[model samples]
Target: MDLSALKQLGMDDREINLYLALFQLGPSSIRDIASHTGINRGTTYESLKQMAARGLISYAPKGKRRVFRAEDPDKLLLLAEEKKSALEGTIDSLKTNIIPGLHHLKPDFSAGNVRFYEGDDGIETVLKDILATVGQQTDKEYCVFSTKSIRHHLYRPFPNYTLQRIRRKIKVRVIAVGDGGEDAEYSERKWLKTDGPVDASYIAIYPPKVAMISMASENYPVATVLEAPEVARSQQVVFDALWGFL
Candidate 1:
């Protein structure tokens, strides 16, 4: 079976192997488990001690040898619950303590708050960040300056992004740089008149964050996310002014 999931629950590779070996060998001594798994005796001993500390295993001195036994397999559920509780605590701390401190530090590429990503994967990260930052809220909406070439970049890594957005019931107000993009529900699409060939660029305004992306360089897709309310508001105003013209 895949023990990677168990590893995520905080067990290491040797620990997983030893745990499984203990399960098979029943009440086993360090020597028995080491021989069964081909792990070094010292490492096996240390792992067993760690497992015991985690309450995953137990041992008792029988005559001169200390034999170890795995705890009930059902303890896996307890481990998962504990991890969930710890994660929830961490999330609370992040919202209440960490993020506010980081906000004061700096935000945006030019301002030390901006993160730059290059290549198609980097651009994909920018799009995915939007979805991850916005949780499930029916009225959640975002504004975007969409372009034709954006589709060429996004369709490869995130072919289902639009569909996922629709499913999440997130609304979007888009100003297409050229006469392009299709209409979708819960979205407002307007075209900006252009006389010459438009360079591939997209600016998405989502709350205290604004993401600017350019795909004009073909495979050299780049994006920057700025987390400043004033910047976002200014961009929103510009979008609205352009929006009014369309």
Candidate 2:
């Protein structure tokens, strides 16, 4: 019988063995259950005590000995519901009390919060942050400095990024550093003249934060997010200057 569900309910191998042994042996003493499951009598008794506490098993005095039996399998559903309710309560507490209290301890942006991430998942996180942060802004727009080598890889983790941006009505202005780029709704693109291959790099200038993504050794993607309003404003100024020249 596939008792994998029991494992999901936090039953270890010994507990599972003891539970199963009870089902097979009916109301049995710890010695009988231990012998049936090949677990020592002392360990078997302890496991039964724990399972009984969890309402997974029950025991009765059978003359000088305690005889244990597995409770109805439907009891597993009740156990799962209890776990789910507890988890929901924890989530509510975090949203209502814990997270807000923790936010009070965060350092101010003058220190320039910098975070580094590696791999495609990290890049996706950076992209998601751009959308989320910009989505909340009144302007609903951002700027990008994208190069040909890095442009294709940027959206691999979020293929529908442009579509989502358009759906959210978030506009973007892109200054392409090499040959290729495509136009999309709520987006404008301009190219920079280049004589040789540019290093794979992409920069996003959203107010209060700038995300830089680059290709590292072996073409692995890495990203850095700097949360500094002053730095982002400076980059936006420079991008606007170059944008007008191109």
Estimate TM-scores for all models: 0.84, 0.75
Q: Model 1, 237: alpha-carbon shift in Å?
A: 1.3
| Number of colliding residue pairs in each model | 4, 0
Judged by lDDT against the true structure, how good is candidate 2?
0.91
lDDT of 1 by residue, 1-246 (tens): 887889878898889999999989999889999999999899999999999999999999999999999999889989899999999999999988998888667534455657887877887788788877654445588899978766577657777888887887788999887777988987899887778877788889986789988874766778889877789889888988888988
**RMSD of each predicted structure:** 2.8, 4.0
lDDT of 2 by residue, 93-170 (tens): 998899989866777754449999998899999999999999989999999999999987888989999899999999
Best by TM-score: 1
> Residue 212 in candidate 2 has what lDDT?
95
Give the whole-model CA lDDT for all candidates, comma-separated: 0.84, 0.91
Q: Mind sharing the TM-score for model 2?
A: 0.75
How much does candidate 1 score in TM-score? Answer: 0.84
Between which residue pairs do clashes occur in model 2? none
Backbone clash total for model 2 is 0
Q: Which stretches of candidate 1 lie over 4 Å from their true place?
A: 105-110, 134-139, 149-151
